[model samples]
Target: MPSRRQVLALLAALPAVLGLPEEARAAEPDVTAGPDWDATDIAVLKGVLAAVYGPNSDRCDAVEALTASFAWLDGERKALVRMLPSLFDQASRVLVPTISAFHDLDPVQQQACVDDWAASPLAFRRQIFGALRQLLLAHAYADPATWPDIDYPGPWLGRYELPIHPLRFGDPELP
Candidate 1:
């Protein structure tokens, strides 16, 4: 009969004897699950935009900024949403608030943001799209997904998808 000490030692060494090596067991890398933006995040964004652009900026600027912001956020959200599409069905949760918050503004107040922006269509588009690209890049780096099928549309598909989708104003590839 094996003593308790011998039994315990054998149990500990059983894995090696069975050919299951310790090296085979490794922990998975940590990936953040999803966007955790809350109301405070919205407030922070609003405050930041207001501060950088100034309080008196009009609706056109606000909407244009928002359009650009959404384009960028779409890239970020799409990256995550594609990874766990079923889990992150509520990707619009982050964006909807931005629209609603702007919608809540009275007409005059909204226009103020618009008037403050550059009149050149190209400049406006550039600023908006640039901001969005940066935002999405930041999001992708933070929550990378290993799955390939979860990728966002490439340039070709991106153009096709944006205009048809209500969330996008126009194609990012456009001049």
Candidate 2:
């Protein structure tokens, strides 16, 4: 049985023993959620996309396209969206030197952090970077609006626009 004073002393020392700062021992604030992501998560992702794709160019608006891509992803790629917050949190903890979220960093810092992750020897970090890059590229290229800028003339003869033509092999009047 410990004295009350001894118990108080032990409680005060507990944080240090656990390797956590007193402030860090407190409960974290709830992340403010958006439709598919928390605000910070969305900001972190947008920053990453901007770093990888570059700012909107004359050929295509990368930011707009990325926004649209996120919207598409929310509907079609729920798993990815669901994973983003945790992934961003993990990256922030691993990459940021000081106590700060990824979205809290400045653009230059964000880019540097992402670059560091990209250059990391760890296979998983590289894989995450590759996956993010591929996601951006896939979305950017998939949009028909971006095709002309990429110099893809699209289908040979507006095949998508052609109405369903019934088989004419057996019917002479089908033409």
Candidate 3:
């Protein structure tokens, strides 16, 4: 059922996706996750943030941003996040039987857990990982505190009032 082009495209990406030394495209996978978590759950969240965002990610108040983002989600999503930790055990491919609590795991273990879920063989696990990551990332990018590091000056709209000199919303004809 494979088309030649699709097959070829996958074949082309295979070498790079294989973790080859020279392949830079897959050198780093963009992994992100956000959760609608409880106060008690946040202790582990900070560790996950440090692991997923790397050592220098503490400048932004990610905890607050994540908390706010979590607050905005509905009941179903909130429940999923509450349960995300338990799902971690199902994501790992390694034979490191009897995984510890996420908070108890070292930083390296946390990162591995995220990576495993993101790239899990089970589609649902990957889907949840994708959803969690996207949720966090969307909120983080929207937070003004995160802008300085990325060098984004706040939105231009705030600084500029475009002149509607020739036309207004009502008039369709050109001025």
Candidate 4:
């Protein structure tokens, strides 16, 4: 076994080596939760957003987008989503032992936590990271404010007014 000094050195390097930040939380990042999401879920979602995007990403209306996102889900899926916060917390306990939830950690720490999961050895964890990332992109990018960042000039509704092609999937009379 390693000596005490070696263990302390390891602990100091834990954040970078393990992707769990050791810095104190400077401030709480602002994020809006939908009516369907409880505070805990919202917190976890905020942590995810900070990790995927920058910590200061506050332009997009997360609440509105998530509300619509959840509306399309079936009851079973919604229940599963509702339980994700606790699940994330339980899994992340090793990283931030003092914190009750993943979001309780500082943004830097939260990002570290997300990074850990994204690169986790477990396939399940990697899948969870992908799902969270895709979910954020789905809703966050839907907001017009984020369109410029991704060079997405919103949807093309003018397709109805002017046909880009003679044969379209939605158009009738296609053989």
Candidate 2 lDDT, tens digit per residue, 37-75?
566665666777767766552344443555555544433
Lowest-lDDT window of 10 residues in candidate 2? 27-36
Candidate that would win on TM-score: 4
Candidate 1 RMSD computed on C-alpha atoms after optimal superposition onto the true structure = 17.6
Clashing pairs in 4: none
Model 2 clash number: 0
Whole-model Cα lDDT of every candidate shown, in order: 0.39, 0.65, 0.63, 0.69
The global Cα lDDT (0 to 1) of model 3 is: 0.63
Clash counts for the predictions, in order: 15, 0, 4, 0
Let me know the TM-score candidate 2 reaches against the reference structure: 0.54
lDDT of 3 by residue, 53-125 (tens): 6656566576677665665566566667656644543334232332665666677877877776666688877
Candidate 4 deviant stretches above 4 angstroms: 1-35, 95-100, 158-175
How far in Å is the alpha carbon of 36 misplaced in model 4? 3.4
For the record, the alpha-carbon RMSD of candidate 2 to the native fold, in angstroms, is 16.3
Of candidate 4, the 10-residue stretch with the lowest lDDT total is 24-33
